[model samples]
Target: MSNYSIKAISNASNDAIIQLKELNISFGITEKTSETLPNPAELFLGSFAACILKNVERFSGLMQFGYKKAELLVNAVRLENPPRMDELTYELTIYTQDEKLNSTLLKKNIEKFGTIYNTVKQTCKISGNIIVHKNV
Candidate 1:
């Protein structure tokens, strides 16, 4: 059996917060309109972004890419009626002092083995692009 548990709290104002007991994190949610709290769907996308970033950081070290900086942008589209995610797009920019390393390989390492990418890809359609810049 898994030793992880999820817990959360919310206010009358519709603000929601959750904690991952295993990871010891407390995250809050707020609505875009303020009429209600941020929906679970939003959190899902946010979690995916976090997961991918974490994996990239770990993989970068193992791959010895000499990264100077990294940034990611994530966007999602939600379906109507069912109010579910239809598509997700990610763009990652990596800065490194070495230009000889193929950016394509770096992108493949992140997208193929990233925990979040694997998890999301199993359930939904996912696609992304990566850009590497010579660090100044």
Candidate 2:
């Protein structure tokens, strides 16, 4: 197993930022009273969305799929008692000129082989729907 570590620091006004080393990315977090940025929980949801989006694009290329445009939307509901994400839903729309593309196959490739999807699906209720938009 590969192990990783990162660091986060809080600024003077209670604004905090965490840097992800593997990806060389950083995100800011803060509270309404402390700062204007979103909290950590919201960042988690955004991270999940970003991870899936990146994976889907890579998978689409590997599967030799024709696409004109693509978009993804992610929503997550957090539980109040235990402070955990309870339900997560995703909607992915793919636009392409080819009508013979098997959406089911694309979805299977994503759900079955996507490293991030598989990892997150194990702990949370992860569900996604795929839609194909035919080009005119």
Candidate 3:
């Protein structure tokens, strides 16, 4: 088994900075308020999106498929009473010239193996579609 961890420091307000020791990256975090920085919920959704994209790139390399670029747009619905995410949807656009690559299979593999995707899928409804575009 693999272990992962991060450190977060919060002030008096609803904001904090998270440090990823392994990645050597730090990000400012805040609650869902009027702050300009990203909130926790947005960060969660973004992490999920990033995980899917990472899997896409990994599969493309392993499957010998080439893509010019990939883009993901994610939307999340939050319930007020309990203040939790109800559902999440995303649209993945892949620009590629590889016609032999099956988009359906690629999406399935990502959703099946993605760490963040599977984790979030357990608590919220996850729905999305993959759109492949022929790169000129």
Candidate maximizing TM-score: 3
Candidate 1 clashes between residue pairs 3 or more apart in a chain or in different chains? none
Ranking by lDDT: 3, 2, 1
**TM-score for all predictions?**
0.77, 0.78, 0.88
Q: Supply the global lDDT for candidate 1.
A: 0.72
Q: Put down candidate 3 lDDT per residue, 25-72, tens digits, no spaces.
A: 333453454366676777888899889999998999877798999999
Which residue segments of model 1 deviate by more than 4 Å?
Answer: 1-3, 21-39
lDDT of 2 by residue, 1-136 (tens): 7786888777675556676765533344434443555667667777677776776678767777777777888888889887788888999898887766678888787788766677778878988898988863
Scored by lDDT, the top model is: 3
Task: Write one digit per residue (lDDT tens) for candidate 1, span 1-136.
Answer: 3355688887664456676755533334544444444456667877788877786678767776567777888889888877677789998887877655567776787778777678788766888888887754
- Model 1: weakest 10-residue lDDT segment is 24-33
Which lDDT values do the candidates have, in the order given? 0.72, 0.74, 0.84
